[model samples]
Target: MRFANQTATFGVAALLAAQPAMADVTPQQVWDDLDAYLQSFGYEVSATESMAGDTLTVSDLSLRLAIPDANGGLSMAMEQMTFTDTGDGSVRVDLPQSIPISVDVAPEDEESMQMVIDHGLEGFSMLVSGSPGDMTYDYEATRMTLALGSLTVDGEDIPRSAARATLSAGPVDGETQVTVTGEQRHIVQTASLGELAYDIFGRDPEVDGDSENSGMFKGSMSGFAIESDSTVPMGLDTSDMPALLEAGFSVSGRMSYDASESQFSGTEDGKATTGESSSEGGSFEFALSPDGVRYATSAQALNISMTTPEFPFPLSAEMDEMGLSFSAPLSKSDEPQDFSLGLTLAGFTTSDMIWNIFDPGQVLPRDPATIALDLTGKATPYIDFLDPEQVETLEGGDTKPGELNALTLENLQVKAVGAEITGSGAFTFDNSDLETFDGMPAPSGAIDLTVAGANGLIDRLVEMGFIPEEQAMGTRMMMSMFGVPGSEPDTMTSKIEVRENGQVFANGQRIK
Candidate 1:
């Protein structure tokens, strides 16, 4: 994998650097710029270089990665590579059939360990073309494969393992734009995997000198696809708080998984258990920015079933559909930033074997359930989250300034179990006088809430022996004073308010 990554990075860098103001640029110039760029990022790059007409050949290409506390570094090499100038402001990259990679860790030890890997690909190529300010590259791999060559301990091979994976990403597209007089770089990249499959089979990975192994497990996922697109600020001084805030980078992507199947069986303590899970497709989306972040996920259908001799019944559960959405603000400002979250589950039925023991008669509503909330507030951070010194200040006293301008419950909703509840409210705080509320800032506002089917729910609970008759009677008596009956049947409404003078009221009547 590291070999594949380095190969891709070098190939892309060469092509990107080749984009010139005109089509008269030479191939050698591109490699020169690439070498300089890699050097700036702490990478040692070397290759056998040659030029033939409009083509440049870089054979035996090798790269050494940089690490903090290691005498020896990770390195990889390719047998042969080529970069050709199309003479029309375009460049093409050609790669070899295989690349070898090796890693050495704990080099200080006399008997250090090492691992070797080999990556194989078929029909791997990239084409780069565009103007100077904006460059685009398109690459494709018809078939991609990987193998773990060997892992040696004290310069000796351990128990040989059999593991491999084959992947296919038809084509990937990337675009880079330079702005702010080349001070800032904006990049958008997208790629996808299709018909991706992998399998693993390892037995008794050398437990002791004599090799007494404990357990073994093997599983595989098939018929799933993943696609992603992201946009972010690259090569920025993240330590500079103000510069980071100004950049305000963001990324958004979606993944769609089709009908997929996965199964696993494991043995432990001389016992074997098997579990299988499947999905009928789903989609998830997420986005992040300096100001806020948002995410949404939904699933069409999912099922998990397991069979074991230790259990009397085959345990299984499933959901027809599920959805969730959330958003949070990440900025600090005097004005409040709005935040909201919501969730919904539909047709969430369970297997009969499990439900029969809990609710045989179906006392609960099997319908869809939903909950949502929205809030607006201001947070005063006493220290910069990126400042090392300021972060240390957070260790003492209050992490944030004891200041809140306002808080508003813009919306609140919950609908489940044959009942519905909804409310909304807003409040302003008095930071000038915190003593009035015992060191907490005084707040004044009113919240209007309404509940439907409350009376029916109470009646059902009493009939089910969950609530005693005496207790139900006391609850009804208490509701008679504070709850205002709505026009709808079994419905009630209440208006709760708090005054700056520390007074509490319900339904226009003073409660405290």
Candidate 2:
């Protein structure tokens, strides 16, 4: 899988570099620039170039890249590509209808594998504007498709029916702008697709030809779009991520879709099972740089349903919204670096059939559940994770990689079953005094918490036999020791604190 991903990345880079530029740019200059760009990434590029009138034709274009650690490599070939001067300070690009790619990967001390893929395009058009150093490309296509042609393992061809995969997208439009300044190249891209779909199937070759031995998956997405910006160093090596970051490489992007759905069917434990899932909308964002990395995703109006031989009834679930976000530093630093994390799952509910398994009498409230958290903190790292050598040293288990300096809980909430809990807190850790906490950093801070309908929820739990009366009594006693009764019935509030000297307290009373 890693080798395949590397091959794809190289293929994309080659295609992007081949895009022509306009405004007094000659066909020969465009070809030269393409060659230089691919060579910058250590790809062996070769092609036959010819000129006729205002058109420049490149035939038998090939790109080959060798993987460093793995004793393997990949190669891609395209039949023909053309760049024609339009006489109006713009160039029109003509791409082949089909492209074939081949990849060979051999992991250390493992059997070798090879893959063949075919890419197709229909009704595609592209126009390039601006100079070679600063270019703009506008492209559109009616449809595009990718299909797995063949696979071979250990020099033996695998049966075509054993594995199959295909992906298709239609009515796509996009634009790319590239600007070069001194040692840096800045790229900005925006694209959108009316719809996208995929299909995959697999069967165990060792198993007899039976429907039960095969599995299939299909999915589709609508109104998909993406926007991205990146800053890359000139003549940069794609490998050696640590060096890439040191050379000032960074990228950020966002992808979104209006709707999506998927379905899967297979046999599990000799029993048939099937499942389907759908979502109204979703979006994802990511960024990477020398300083840190950031990622976030959100979805809305999600629903899932499934059936299996083990279950007598179909199961289903629904969620109104789900979201998650995380960001942290990767570089080594003596001083603390900023970090954050957040998660939210709101309006989550399950089918009554599932609820009945645990709450048959429906003694507990069936209201949708909600859980949320938001946190921020600062930490110091002793080694740069992106550096392979440093990673190996840290992985030896003799060194501590980092230490937490501070943390702040901006918000936390959990609501369900006729009860709700909320809290907020902040803390600073004394990394120099791990002995005070028995090998853990000493922390000093305070947290304020509130609970609503706790007593009523406890009573319902006891009545439903989920908990014994003795346990309920012990729980209430523990709450009373730390919390004060609120004005509202069944509500309680509490304050928990840790002093600089490692003393613990509840409200104004010292506990340790």
For this target, which candidate reaches the highest TM-score against the unseen true structure?
Answer: 2
Global lDDT of each model? 0.60, 0.82
Q: Candidate 1's residue-wise lDDT over 202-236, tens digit each? A: 44454433333333333333344443333323355
Clashing pairs in 1: none
**Cα lDDT for residue 198, candidate 1:** 50
Give the runs in model 1 whose Cα sits over 4 Å from its true position.
1-48, 60-76, 100-120, 145-181, 196-281, 284-289, 292-296, 306-311, 320-342, 374-377, 386-398, 401-411, 428-441, 474-482
Model 2 regions lying over 4 Å from their true place: 1-23, 209-212
Model 2: residue 103 alpha-carbon error in angstroms: 1.9
TM-score of each: 0.73, 0.94
